[model samples]
Target: MKQDNEAVGAQEESFSGDESQSLVPDANYQEEFSWFSVILPFLFPALGGLLFGYDIGATSGANISLQSPELSGISWFNLSAVQLGLVVSGSLYGALLGSLLVYPIADFLGTEEEGTYHCSCTIPSWGLITAYAPDLGVLLVGRLLYGLGIGLAMHGAPLYIAETCPSKIRGTLVSLKELFIVLGILLGYFVGSFQINVVGGGYMYGVSAPIALLMGIGMWLLPPSPRWLLLRAVQGKGSIQELKEKASFALSKLRGRPPGDNVSERQIEDTLISLKSSYADQESEGSFLEVFQGPSLKAFIIGGGLVLFQQITGQPSVLYYAGPILQSAGFSAASDATRVSVVIGLFKLLMTWIAVLKVDDLGRRPLLIGGVGGIALSLFLLSAYYKFLGGFPLVAVASLLLYVGCYQISFGPISWLMVSEIFPIRTRGRGISLAVLTNFGSNAIVTFAFYPLKEFLGAENLFLLFGGIALLSLLFVMLLVPETKGLSLEEIESKILK
Candidate 1:
């Protein structure tokens, strides 16, 4: 890659820019990044991603046992249709509430503090309650709370990576959290599948408790976000030298700069300038409405619009109701149909792993366009197979695998990565919250509409609808989204808002 050293120190108008100072990193800064430092944030915080994914897969995977009178999935496995609907969708509704709360949480209590509370304490508490709920209503409440916790975690996890990670590999690092999500889902599937009859089928719901509790404790020990500590350092509440020391220590750990003794004198000075500039960019604390106006609007559109297309790609529908979809296509045995979900979980986990590796190398734009274009074609073929051919089970399976592959690689991970990347730090919490709101909003629409569409148009025409959306998404990426590979956060803002 060519050098843009000159661009770093140049001042530009910014919503969350460091204090009018030129604090660009030296071009070679990334070369000295430590592997240990780079991986720790993912290890400590990305566990939250695992917990979130686990909740999603755990509920759907356990649905099989819950419906099975022979197993202990749900004590009220024989509930009425209306009751079952509530049981299943309770968490998603909670997630919507959590996503919408982001702006208020940031404006009032602050995202840094609020995120810790949601992830560590709220999640574990809800998981345990859901695990041991005395009745269906209690279980529903627990599930709803679980959704709220993970919804907040989803916002916090990616935003943490976006802020801590250097721009050179931010997409890849952030996307890695997406893989942990699928891995958690995969674990939930297998865990529930193995102990189908365990604890009255409450195993899946309760399993997250220990993990979340551990995560809750781990968060207390980890340092607060450097950006956040800087934000708190407003109006000389403390010494500027002290803020720089803390920021440098945390940033060095996250970005992997050498220790003060080992770093070159000039590099140390440049690092301080960059840190100061970043702190300077923080918006005076207020409502998040500022980003919705003026130059920031472009960034918001790209962020929100990207997640909208991601949801419309039909992933939530597939995840929530894979059993019925599989059985409809030809897997007649209920146990077989349920087990196939395990296969789907594994497939998603593996493909997303590949995406974690490739996102940095190929850049975000090519992967988004390529993966979604493949998804569009797969959806069209799957629709035709279900509609016209009717009896070819293997064909349906193959098409589904192809669709899953395309989705995991493209829309699945990149959407989250871009959400964290595109927004400036000033409104990042709210920006990502809005994008997540878009994601959950689209997911809710698709999830609710899938059954109705299936009833009226059948699976064939329904998928054709998704196929059309996927095609539109391709055009959206091609024309509107920029290639954000290897650019610093401030540089990206400068380029996009220029």
Candidate 2:
């Protein structure tokens, strides 16, 4: 322990004179900022979020399409309730499997390569397979493959965005990932509306294929994360001086500065010292066991808990079955229900934009706590409409919109944002992989059980249970989650984790 402290001290002492001054932002540094450079890198990684959202939106309509007799010419296409649940949740189960598979390999691959591989490979493959599947088994295989990509994208995008962005704008950039997801959902809804009667939902399933291929190509054009380069240096992938040169080049590009500029060089040197200090007392690479000890353990508890609640409070089930849920609330026509979903998607996009604007300014806790409080209230309103106000269909619609809007501001984006922020550099990859695993595992369970649970508990009682969970989530944020707005990754590790 004493030796560890000494190592940290030595690392800190390496920064001197102008190098130390670079740690504090100056007017010239502010003037050098290029929004286009920063936003360009962020845009490619965020397409992963779009893929996840498109699946959610397209599947909602696909569920309705699969129920029609036109597609039921195949004996198995006329699915029982249990079989239908499996079809709707097949991707989620695949996502669960994908998260477990990615846990050990996350550190080795890094986020950029992971994003590129999954987009270029998994997404297009799933789209083609699902679009032309001959039977239930084939369709399900396609869903699982698509879901595998979602798990990878969901794990990598936020972490990449968080690491590459300037700290002052980090919250906004990271939150834009959720914005892309919402846009995808909206796009999916529009396509589903047009393709609802198409045989076997082929058009709906195939639409994202070309777009995902384009995104994969774009990923190749962006710079790698500077922090990831530094991590490779710490892991002894190459000589320290050689890796530092590469890291400096990447950082200069990200900061929109000339590589040889004095300010850029000082900033890179300061970043290196901060990263080394963060890693000083730990092993060059982190192990699964190490993640459960001390500060990493605390980070897991916070990150894991947020993701757990994010699903259990019922966001996935609500979005996944929105068309049917709206139908039950008295939009009797299937087309009318899908149209309502598009409107709801638009509201969700707007709400996520509000969060992107306010997150760095208002801090994480306020949005989490306040939005959760609203979520609980919305759930209760839904329960009331189902139980005693059955005649008032509009009340249920209003409550559902409220729930989606509140969630956009709270658990929807913030949970992933916090997960990206909390872990130490060494264990961040595995730590976040575990959190994503927890997220998908719970989502699969909740989504698969939504039909049965609603049947058993009734819509009123199930919503009430979700309302209770939302209240508990609100309490969790108030008591345990810290405000991380405006802090650098190194500062967060030293102050919050310690």
Candidate 3:
């Protein structure tokens, strides 16, 4: 009895000691900004975003170069319009397959980290194949392989941003994927403008591969996701001591505390347990059909529909043939039309940067609505200039710039942002893959069928059709697309459920 009393006394003293120490931190403990906390975690994963940007940009120039009639007499194999369309669009569908089919298994088989590395490595190799291919058949095969890499990176990059970033800055980081994409496109144009063959023929394709490989190498230096590390602990995969140490570091990084910061072990342990419980709740609530059953279905509709609308706004058509379209409208000189394309690409870069900064501030739905509405008006003006007035070049040019600006600020970035935000964890991978597939599928249709569309509707009338789609897209945003600004994933899911 005396020994038991002594032990009880020791326990009480230890408890009191812990109570005296502020586990959560003192009121005055200054939390200096840590790169490891905010930037490192978000930045490295976004290397995938950069790779994605490079691939999209590479094709814009390369596909055009490959389709040149002059290439017909070159040492390279002969080309036809049909083969050209296949080369340009073949990658898009390859991307569709990569996203819908590959991501699920890639994600299942390894960590997002491992899956990301796999995608990155393949992208560059595909670029090399396209560069040296002897014939159109081989070239199409290269683009397809390239598309597969693009599909995985496109899907995985944003997903990483969504999963890893803190909510306050999540929009900025995820939307940065779009920013990289635009930047790559702009850079690609620079290289291709002087000599499309110089950049497009072999060198630029080869260059992009090395850059992707570098980013893949960088991926290993960053920490695995805090949530995934915690999940491992819950599943009892690693030794208890090992899991605790790693989890402690991740939790510290997430909370913006330094290694020597005065956080208690108990606090770290509590957070791990809380994560386990939260993950359990997410897993238990959904069955196989649950994604299609309830509010999840609503999320699917909004996400999928948004991408479809984004494409139908004629973004792909304009991008694929900016120079041709401008020339057709009245800028008969190729030099003048190319200048306009340069202006448009630069403008797109600027607006999307604005979006990256203001997305969380302006909110998602407002931008989508405003952007689409502006697109409709701009397209209408362009059509009016072409059809009713017999081509006022100045007015048409201004309208096209306005249309591109609105798109950059609105659908181009926001559509991607929403796809990252809308789905539940269980369906996030598959849901996003489906949305990406829709993105490429629509891109393929617009790109391949544009010639026939122009033949059927005429150029002026085509702008009008695009205008109508933009206006209708505005309605879609208003009716659907819940506001996701500043909400936790759970809170966002709850809104969808309601």
Against the correct fold, how does model 1 do in TM-score? 0.84
Residue 115, model 2: Cα distance from true site in angstroms: 0.6
Global lDDT of each candidate: 0.69, 0.79, 0.65
Q: What is the lDDT of residue 171 in candidate 1?
A: 57
Regions more than 4 Å wrong, model 2: 1-31, 71-75, 239-242, 256-270, 273-281, 485-496
Superposed model 1: Cα runs more than 4 Å off: 1-26, 29-34, 72-75, 79-82, 107-112, 120-126, 166-168, 197-199, 235-283
Better of 1 and 3 by lDDT: 1
Clashing pairs in 1: 16-281, 17-280, 17-281, 18-277, 18-280, 18-281, 19-280, 72-200, 72-201
Best by TM-score: 2
TM-score, model 2 to reference: 0.90
**Whole-structure CA lDDT of model 1:** 0.69
What is candidate 1's lDDT per residue for 308-360, written digit by digit as tens?
99888787777777666677778766556657768988998899999988888
- Native-to-model Cα distance after best TM-score fit, residue 212 in candidate 3, in Å: 1.1
What lDDT, from 0 to 1, does candidate 2 have?
0.79
